[model samples]
Target: MKDSIGEKQVKVVIMKKFLIFIFTVFGLFVGWIAFMVYSYERSYNEWKSSYTGKIVTNSEKQFSSSSSSTQNYDYKKYSSSSDGNKDDLESLMNMFMKRLFPPTLLDPDYTYAYEKAKSWSKKHLSQQQIIIYLTKYDRYSEDATQYALNKLNVDWKEQALLRAKSYQEFHYSKNKLVEQLINIDKFTQEEADYAIEHVHFDWKENAVKEAESSSNGGNISKERLLKILVEYRKFTQEEAEYAIEHAKIDWLN
Candidate 1:
């Protein structure tokens, strides 16, 4: 049978148990600090070795071969040098910088962080930014961010379509737009064609807009306006002729 505890003794027992728990927590904290210090020292040595051109082979870990299967973590950071777009270097750095450091307190889950980066890229960033944004945030951990980055369902064709619509705001002709989509934005020929077909803008209005907006040195002539619309704006011969006819400009001496 258990002994019946008196009130005074019960209070004492409770105090002792509380003290034991506090001690356990304190001990764990001390151990964690020790581990952190050791890790720092190890990292310092590795940095020194790298600086001295020593291979960090032992520390190098391979996640997998195909990027489809895993996060394709570059222990060195950033995507492969083989990436086609040389122009993406700027946005890539921006995304990498976000992932450089995580919030100190109230850190969200790895998947949340990864998805946040991906969403940002989808709305307003490049593929380079989306690719490595989360992996670096997790310090290259094999977590949900890594998995999501590796296996995301990105629609490049849709991205092309959105960019085309945005460009139409600036009133670029279909020819110039196709060139931008294919060369600068890095869309395939088929994707560029899709964007051109889907983008809605009045080509005649665009030509007139360009003609009226031209700030020429002398009083602008109708023939010069026609040339401007055709050569610079990439308007078709017929479109240029129509714009010149409709644009009621004071072509004075």
Candidate 2:
């Protein structure tokens, strides 16, 4: 009976030792996991602190800047930097982010173009203008950026006025302006007509300006200037006659 009691005590000690061993292994595993998490967070914080809020402009911008009309300006940019460490937790998180949200979903390019469209729209850009700016200059998806443009509530008639102003500043004829709006800028016939009728310009004075501009070569005869005024400029014969008669050019020479 004493021997049995001794064996029982020995078995109890063995079970306690086994339990201690299991608990020790579990504690070590948890500590290791915590340490790794701390290490990754420290690395991420260090990386973030070293680089924050930096801007880089495209030195070789390829877009046209000829039209000098002032517009409300808005722009946005996105960028990320890395040390090329593929095994880091930051890299894993970045991978997860990419999986969770693709470039299309994140759509930094679309956001950039959307903001630009909003700015240009506020400053009187036509829908076509915004569409062109996004697809041609910014190289964004035409459909997507256009969707963004359509989402904005803008004054189309005001845009037409702005378009008219741009052309009229260059002394475009009434018909020429309308033709450009319809054929070039994709405005409807009705919309073009509305813009043309509303824009405040004297077609006769515009004809005179046209005649003067062409007569600078000193080779424009009266008949040729009259043809240019009436046929090419879509002016009435009476208007053309008045323009040629009142033009500041030597048609007699």
Q: For residues 148-197, write the lDDT of model 2, one tens digit per residue.
A: 77667776876787777778756677778888888877676777778888
Record all residue pairs in model 2 with backbone atoms less than 3 Å apart, i.e. clashing: none
lDDT of each: 0.64, 0.71
Residue range with the least summed lDDT across 10 consecutive positions in model 2? 72-81
Clashing pairs in 1: none
Q: Which predicted model would earn the best TM-score?
A: 2
Backbone clash total for model 1 is 0
lDDT of 1 by residue, 151-252 (tens): 555676677788788776677777988888777776778878877887777887887666667724337877777788788889998878887777766674
**lDDT of prediction 2:** 0.71
How many residue pairs of model 2 clash at the backbone?
Answer: 0
TM-score of each: 0.46, 0.53
User: What TM-score does structure 2 among the candidates reach?
Assistant: 0.53
